[model samples]
Target: MAAASAGRLDPVDGRRTSGARGERVAAPAAPARPAAVRVRPGADEDLRPEAEAALRRLVGRDDAVLRDDQWTAIHALVAEQRRALVVQRTGWGKSAVYFVATSLLRARGSGPTIIISPLLALMRDQIAAAGRAGVRAATINSANVTEWDQIHEQISNGDIDVLLCSPERLNNPGFRDEVLPRLAADAGLVVIDEAHCVSDWGHDFRPDYRRIRTLLAELPEGIPVLATTATANARVTQDVAEQLEITGEGAGRSEVLVLRGGLDRESLHLNVLRLGDQPTRVAWLLEALRSTEGSGIVYCLTVSVAEQVAAQLKAAGLPVAAYTGRTDPTERESLEADLKANRVKALVATSALGMGFDKPDLGFVVHLGAPSSPIAYYQQVGRAGRGVDSALVVLLPGEEDQRIWEYFGSLAFPREDQVRATLDALSRGGTQSAQALETQVDLTRSRLEMMLKVLDVDGAVKRVKGGWEATGQGWTYEADRYARVEQARLAEQRTMLDYESTDGCRMAFLRRTLDDPDLRPDERCGRCDNCGGSTLPAAPTTEHVAQARKAMDVPGVVVEPRSMWPTGMATLGIDLKGKISPAEKTEPGRAVARLDGLGWSQPLRELFASTTPDGEVPVHLRRAAAQVLDAWDGLQVDGVVCVRSTTRPVLVEHLARGLAKYLDKPFVGFVGPLGGHEAPPRHDVNSAMRLAGVAQRLGLDLTPAASAGLAGRSILLVDDRVASGWTLAVAGRLLRQAGAGAVLPFVLAQQ
Candidate 1:
C-alpha cells in the first residue's frame, strides 16, 4: 500500500480536517517521558485506541480506522513483537500499518523504524506521510548523497522517527560497514515494503533484498518486523515469509504471522484488445486516450517504445510525456507531479514507473505490450483506480512480447562456468571495479553486476571501498535451482499468453496466477470485455491508422559514435584506452530504424531473428534503406566498406552492394575477419570484450586496385546492425589508419 498524502488535523478531535498538500503539520506533542521507559519491551496494554488515533493523523480522515487485518499486523508488531508478512491488494492501507506502528513505537520510547523501501518515489511519498502523522522521517537514497551526513546526524540525535532507505543501500560499502550496524542494534521495528522483491519467485526480484536476512539476524530479539506487498502469489509469499523467519542459537526460530488478502480490484474494469499490428494498436490507443476520463499511464515493454508512443500521442495534440529508466530523476519527479495534477493526459512509461508511484485518482492503464507475467501486469495496473470508483485496464498484447520476454530471460543467472570465472578473477585480483572485471569476464556490465550482487549476498564476495573482493567462502553453483527458476519463468510467460487469450474473467485469471487465497472457481469481475461490461472501439478509424503509420514510417535514428575507448582494454591484451582520437572517429551516423522502435522494428526483427536465414536484404527494407540515404542531409561518400559478419555475411554484403550502388560509390572491399580468430556473440559481451574481439578479427582488407583511390576519400561503413557500436568504432579506426579521409557509419538497425 502507498502512503497517504499529507493533510491538516482537527485540533479538538485529532482528526484530519483538510489536505495540507504535503505541508508539514505539527504533530501533537507527547507527554515528556524518560527514554528508558519508552524502550521497555512489548506493549502489555491494548494499543488499538492509540493506533486508531495515529491512523487518523496518518490518513487525514475523521473516521479513519484500521481494517481488522491492518490492526492484526500492527498488533503482531507492537504487542507480540513478532515478524509478520502482509499480502494485501493495492489501496489496502499497508503503509498505514507500518507508519501507525512507527508512531506508537516511537511514543513508547523505541528507536526509529527502518523501512526498506524500493523506489525513490515511494520514499518521497512515505516521508510526506510520516510528516503528516507528526513523525519525523528522513531518507537515505541515491538522490540524497550530499545530505547523508545531515540525515545520519539526525538519526544519531533521536530526531528521526522513521528512516526510509532503498535495499541497495544495505550493501553500500560505507553504509554497510558503518551505519547499518548501529541501525540494526537500535532500530525499534523493521519494515520491508514491497516484500515480494525478497524472493526470487517474485516478478520483480532484486538481489539486494536478500541482504535483509543478515540485518534480521543481527537485530536484537523482540524487535518486531513487518514485510508487506500488494502483488505476491502463495509461492512468493511463502518464500518471503521463510526469509522473514529469524533463526538464532538462543532465540531458536521465530514464526512469521502470514496475513494474505484477496487480489481483487473491483474498481478496475479489465479488457484485452487484440489489435492486429503496431499501427492499429497505436491508433486505438490514441482514440482511447481522447475518450478516457482522466489522466493515467500507458505502459510499454521497452524504453524506446515508451518514447515513441509518447511522441506519437503528443503529435496528435494529446498532453503526454514519457517516463522510463532513461528519464532523469529530477524530470521523473516533474512528470509524476504533472500526472498527479491532471496536467497531462498520460505518461507513456516503462516498468521504471511501476512499483510505488502514488497517484490516487488515475483513470486508466493501457499496456502497449503485455508484461511477461500476470503478477507483473497486475502490479503495473494497480497504480490506477486507487481512489476512483472505476478505472479502465486494457491490454494490447503484441506478437513481439514473447520474444522480449525471452530476451530478458536470457539475462538470468549465468552458467556455472561464467560464475566460476568471475569468482576466479576476484579470488586472484584483490579488488577490481566492474569495468575492470568486464575485460576478464564474457558477461555484459549489467549481467556481471547482477551476478556480483548475488555473490555478495551469498557471502562468496564482498563489496568494499574500492570495489569487490572474494570472501574466500566456498559457494555452490546451484545449477538445479537456477534451472528450476528458468523453467518457472517460461511457465509464467506461457501463463501470460494464456491470460491474453482467455475468454474467462480477466481478474479471476490474474488472481489464480497469484494464488489468491480468496479466489473462487466461478469468480468473475462482471466488468470486463469478456463479461459484457465496457469495451473499446473494435478497430481504429482508417484516418488515425494512416496517421500512425505515417508517423512510424518516417524513421531514422541517429547513431552516436563512440567517444571513449572502453576501460581495462589492456587486461584484454588490447592497448586502447581513454578517448579515441577525433581524427580516427567515425562521423555521426544513421540507421533506418531502431530494432526496438514501432515502425520498421517488425520487419527488422523478422529479418534478424535467430531462426531467419541470412540472405539479401528484403525488398521492402531495401526501399527503406534507400529512403534513409536519400534523406541524408549532407552525406557524401566516395566508397563503401562492409564489416564481415560471421553470422550474416551474405546479408551484410548484399546491403553494402545495394548502398554502394544507390550512392554511386565504389564498393571498396570488406573489413574481412582474421581466419584464426572467432568473435564471440556481440550481445553477450561487454564493451571491452566486444571491442577486443572486433579489433582482433577485423582489418581493412582492401586489394591493391580498391586501395588505389582510398587515400583522401570518404567511406561509408556498412553493417547489418549495431549493438555495442564497438565494431564500427574499431573498424573506423582501422580504416582511418589505412588512409581513408573520413568514415561514416550506417546500419540497417540500431539494436
Candidate 2:
C-alpha cells in the first residue's frame, strides 16, 4: 500500500480521511461515547471499550474486537507505560497492538510513535494499516530519501501520528546524530518489529538491530516500548527481553512485561517429502503446484535455484516469477502485488521474501530445499495459513541443503585476529571506508562491512559520513560466547535434520524445537500427513521427471569479465587503477555452471570438496565441458592456456587438456607461479588482495615454440573455477599482453 499523505486528525470523530485511500471506514458507534474514542490521560476508567472501538476502525470491520492478550499488550503500552515483548504467532494481531496503542497514545496528546521496522514491505503495510486506523503515518527508509525532509517537517508540526524507519536507519550518521535524538526525547512509544533479530541466537540475527539497544537506552523513563516477533524460542525471547530492560536508578534492571503465547497453528498442515534428487523434486513441485488450491510461495535456498525453478515452472506453462535479493526493488513491489492479487501461481523466492510480506489467504507453501534451521523453517512456513482455514506446508529436503548451510555458517563472526586487524586499521585513520580497509584485511567485502556494523554497535567503532573511525574504546573478542553461539547453530542444524526424519507429528516437532511454553508432550497436530489428515498429490509422472531433467541439463552461465581494477591496488605496489584497457580485456566468458546451479551443482560440489584428491577430469564433466564448447557458436580459439591451480593442479590440467582436445587447438603451456613466490590463499579475500597476489605471483610459462606462435592467436583460458574473477582477469591480461588476439575464459564452475 502507498503511504498516506500527512493530515490532521478529525476533531469530531478522530478519524483522518484526507488523502487516505478510498472512503474512510466507519467503526461501530459506541453507546455513551464517540465511535473510536481515545482514553484521556490519567483516566482511572477501563480503556478496553475505547481500545475495542479503535481496533474496529483499524481492521475496517465493525465486529473487530481486541483479543485478551492484545488488550493486555495495549494497556501496558498506553496506560501502564511499561516495556513489553509480545511473542504471539503471526496473524495474532501484533501490528494491531502497536497501531491501537499509537492511536491511544496520540489521542492523549503524546508525540508520534516511532516504529523501528525491519523491511520496506513491512513499513508500507504499517503505513497503510495506520491510515485505516485514522493515524497519519509516514516513513523514512532508503527507498524514500526525498520524502524524509517532508516527513520530518510533518512530525515537527504534529501532523503525523506514527513514524516508521528501518533499524539500519537508526545508526545512520544523519539519522543518529540528528533525527534520533528528538525522536527519543519526544516519542510516545517505540516499537521494534521482529525483535528476535536483536539477539545473536535468533535465526536471522542482524547487527543493525543491535543499534536498537542504544536507542532504548537513550529513551526517557515511561516512554513505553514494545518488541514483537513470532519465531523466538525461550533463549531468543530471554535475550531480547533483557535488551529491552532499561536501567533504573543505581543501575538496576527495570521491569519488562513478557507476553508469550502458544505457537501452534491449527490452520497449517505440515509435511516433508524426501524426493531423491533435484530433478525428481522439481517434477514433484511442478505437478503439485498445478493442482494447488490458491496462490502461494515456493521457497528455494539460493537465488540461482529460485530463478532456475521459476524458469522451469514458467516453461511448463505455470505463471510464476522469481523473487530474490538481486531483484530490483521496484520489481519486488510489483511482484509482491502480483502475488497478493493472485495474478500468479506462486513466487519462486529465496529468504529475501521471508518476513513482513502479508498475504492473508495464501493457500500453500512448498520448499524446494530445506532451510538450515527449524526456527527459520517455522518462520518461513508461518507466512502461509495466516488468515485462511487451512494451508499446505511441504518441505522437499535436498542433499545440497547441508552444503548451503555450511557455506552460510562460514560467514559467522570473524576471528579475534581479523577483528583486531580491522580496529587497528581504523585506529590510524580519520575515516576509512570499508573498501580501503579491505586492502589491509583478509576478509571479503560483505564480511568486512558486517564486522564494521557489529563494531559500531559495540562502541568500538563509529560510522561517519565518509566511512568509519575508531572510537578509542577497548574491546574484547568474547571467545566463549561466540563459541557457544556457533555450537547452538550446529545444534539447530542437527535438529532441522531430525525434523525431516522424525516419525512424530511435524507440527509438534516444530513446537518442541521452538520451546512452546504451552505445548503438551502428547499433543499431535492431526492436520499433518503423519496423522493421516491429508496427503499430497500422487508422485510425478516419469515424463515430468524427464522433462525437468532435460530442462536443467542445459547449463552455461556467462562469466562477465571484470572491467575495473579493484580500488587500493596501488597500496599493494600495483599501479593498476580504474577501468582496464579494452584492448587488453578478456571477452565475455562461459562457465559450465554455477557452483550452486540445479543441474551441475552436485558433481561440481563433489569435485571441489576439500577432501577430494586432485585427479583426472571425470568423463561426465569432460563431456559437459565439450557440451559448453559445442554450444559456444561464435568461438574462434587458436589454442588453450591453463591457469595453474595451487590446490587442484591435476584437475585443472585435465580440464585444460580435455578442452584443448575438444576444440582441436594446440595446448599452450601453463601460466605457472613464479619460482620464489608461493600462490596466496585467495579464498575469502577481497578483489584487491586477490588480484594483488595473482598479479605478483603468476607469470606466463609458455615454451619458446608456443611463444613464437602466440601472436595474433585467440586463446581459450581454462580454469577449474572462477571466484573473485581476479585470477581470470590477470591471466587474460597476461595472454593479451603476450600478443594473443582475444582471450576467452572457460571455467568448470563459477563460485
- Per-residue CA lDDT of model 1 for 1-751, tens digit only, reads 1112335332212333233221111111221110111222445346878898888888777666566667767877887687888788777678888999899889889898999988788788878888989999999988779999999999999999999998999989999989988987899999999999998988888999989988887888888999989888867877887787777664443667777777777779999988779999999999889888999999999998999999989999999999999998889889988998999999999988866888778899999999998899999898888777789999998988888998899899999999999999999988999998999999999999999999999999999988899999999999998898788888988999999999999889998888776677898889888988766655788998998999999768889999999888987789899999987999999898888879999899999888999899999999999988888899999999998888898999999999999888889988868878655456678888888888888877888987877888899999999999988998999888888899999999998
lDDT of 2 by residue, 1-751 (tens): 1112346332112233243332121111111111121345654256777887787788776645555567767887887787888777776678888989999998898888998877687678778878988999999887788889899889889998999998889768999999899988999999999998999998899999999998898888779999989888878887887788877662332657777777787789999998889999999999999888999999999999999899989999999999999998789889999998999999999988857888878899999888889998998898888667789999999999999999999999999999999999888755988888888999989899899999999999999999999999989889999899999999999999999998899898998887776668889989998887768978988998999999988868889999998888888899899999987899999998998879987789888998889899998888888888888879999999998888888899989988888878889998878987665456778778888888888899999999999999999999999888888888899988999999999999998
Point out where model 1 deviates above 4 Å: 1-46, 250-253, 678-682, 705-708
What TM-scores do the predictions have? 0.93, 0.93
User: Could you tell me the TM-score of candidate 1?
Assistant: 0.93
**Shift in Å, residue 210, candidate 2:** 0.9
**Model 1: lDDT of residue 250:** 45
Q: Candidate 1: how many backbone clashes?
A: 3
Give Cα distance to truth, residue 538, candidate 1, Å. 5.3
| Candidate 2, residue 744: how far the Cα is off, in Å | 0.9
Candidate lDDT (C-alpha), each = 0.84, 0.84
Q: In candidate 2, which residue pairs clash?
A: none
